[model samples]
Target: MATKRLMKEYNSIQKALSDTQEYENIVSLEPTGDLFSWCGVIRGPSNSPFQAGTWKIKIEVPQNYPIAPPKMKFVNKLCHPNVNFQTGEICLDILQNQWTPAWTLLTTMSAILLLLQDPEPTSPLNIDISNLLKSGDIKAYNGLIRFYTHKYAIDSV
Candidate 1:
């Protein structure tokens, strides 16, 4: 049952990515050896500071997933308040304590996409970046983010 559910979810994700006309940002989603693990690339949202960056992400689905949230982390470096600069740990409630079985991989991915655009400063993983964001230095904060994005997330092709 667990494998079946995981496969179903994986298929749905692949289907959604394949239908690129309807979706944006997400560039590719490929299973890494198994249905439970995947690697994806997302082009930064066009309207954001992250624009032109192609970020890589790693997703690991637990055997008891749905009941427990899947582990999602950025594979490339990101300078965001809500993300751990070194570990890439995300500070999102839904991926942690607020997770519910009703949420699917697609929903989680969507949340991550939204997060890139709107990070929550109050519940931040990187205090320094959060301080920069809240210190009324929008230009400086965005500059750092854009710099890191270009340094680590630029697509090879």
Candidate 2:
């Protein structure tokens, strides 16, 4: 059952990427070895500090997927309030306590893109970045993000 659902989700993701411009930032999302493990790349959203950056991620889908959320994490470094600088762990509700069967991989990736655009400072993995946001230091926050984007995430091809 889980394999069937994952194949469906994976197929739909590939089809959308090929047939439409909607998920343009999602560079790729393909299986690593089998249906349960995958890798993906997402170009950061435009008009944001993370612009031009390429972020890679790993996805480990549980056997009961759709019923239980997949475990995902950045494979590249990202300096953001909701992401751990050293570990690349993400702090997001949908990936955790708020997940539901209704949320598909496409929607989850969309939510991650939204999170990049608008971070939630209240709960954070990088306290320094979150503090900068909370303290209304937009310049410093944007600067740090840009620095990290350059240092950790640009893909030329």
Candidate 3:
């Protein structure tokens, strides 16, 4: 069932890419070898610090996918409150405790695009970035994100 489902998703992504729009933020989503490992590229939304960047992500689907959400991490470094700078581990509820079987890989990537725009500082992986946001230093926070986005997030998969 899991393999069948993963194959469906793989085809879905291919179909999505075939369209002209091809998911506005999703640059690409391709399986590495089999159904379990995949790689993707997500372009940052406009009017945001990450606007000029394209971020790559790695995905690992568990055997019980749908029942268990696939694990994802950034291939390029991203400096944000909810993302671990060193490991690229994301701190979003949907990727963790709040996940539901109803969520698809495409929706999850959309959620990540939203995260780039609106970060939740409360549960942060990068203390410095989180603190800046928590303290209401919008200028510095945006500046750092912009800086890092240019430096690290510009690389593609």
Candidate 4:
């Protein structure tokens, strides 16, 4: 049986998708059985080492979604402080215990976009990358990101 919370979440997600202006390279939702999942394609921000690159991500909602936050990860290789190298798991506060009942799919997506724009090194999934980003070595950071962007993001195309 579908709970009221689940129904509301489903409806909200559907409405957001229909209402939002679709970006050429951005996140989108796909239906799977009775559940729904999101597939996100983010264009690297300008001036960032990942610029001109595209990265794919996946957001998997649990059966008890809403009550528990959805899981998100990059489908393609991503070298970021908050993203896991092997599993693609993202380390975002919203997806963890900090999740609130008022948060919606749109809010979560917006947070992700913001994270790409300005990553938080304090709480990161990639320790080395996080340390580098915190060290304020912009050149090295850009170099490493560019290297991965080329090796994993661009070369795949």
What TM-score, over all chains together, does every model reach?
A: 0.92, 0.96, 0.93, 0.78
Query: Model 2, which residues run further than 4 Å from truth?
Result: none
Ranking by lDDT: 2, 3, 1, 4
The local lDDT score (0 to 100) that residue 76 gets in candidate 4 is 85
Q: After superposition, how far is residue 126 of candidate 1 from its true place, in Å?
A: 1.4
Residue 35 in candidate 1, Cα distance off native in Å: 1.4
Flag regions of model 1 displaced more than 4 Å. 20-22
Each model's lDDT: 0.83, 0.89, 0.86, 0.74
| Pairs with steric clashes in candidate 4 | none
Candidates 2 and 3 compared: the better one by TM-score is: 2
Residue pairs with backbone overlap in model 2 = none
What lDDT, from 0 to 1, does candidate 1 have?
0.83
**Model 3 alpha-carbon drift over 4 Å, by segment:** 18-22
Q: For residues 84-111, what per-residue lDDT tens digits would candidate 1 score against the true structure? A: 9998888889999999999977777778
TM-score of candidate 2 on Cα atoms, chains taken together: 0.96
What lDDT is obtained when candidate 3 is compared to the true structure? 0.86
Best candidate according to TM-score: 2
lDDT of 4 by residue, 6-37 (tens): 56766776666667664323435444455556
- Summarize candidate 2's per-residue lDDT along 116-143 as a digit string, tens digits: 9999999999999999999999999999
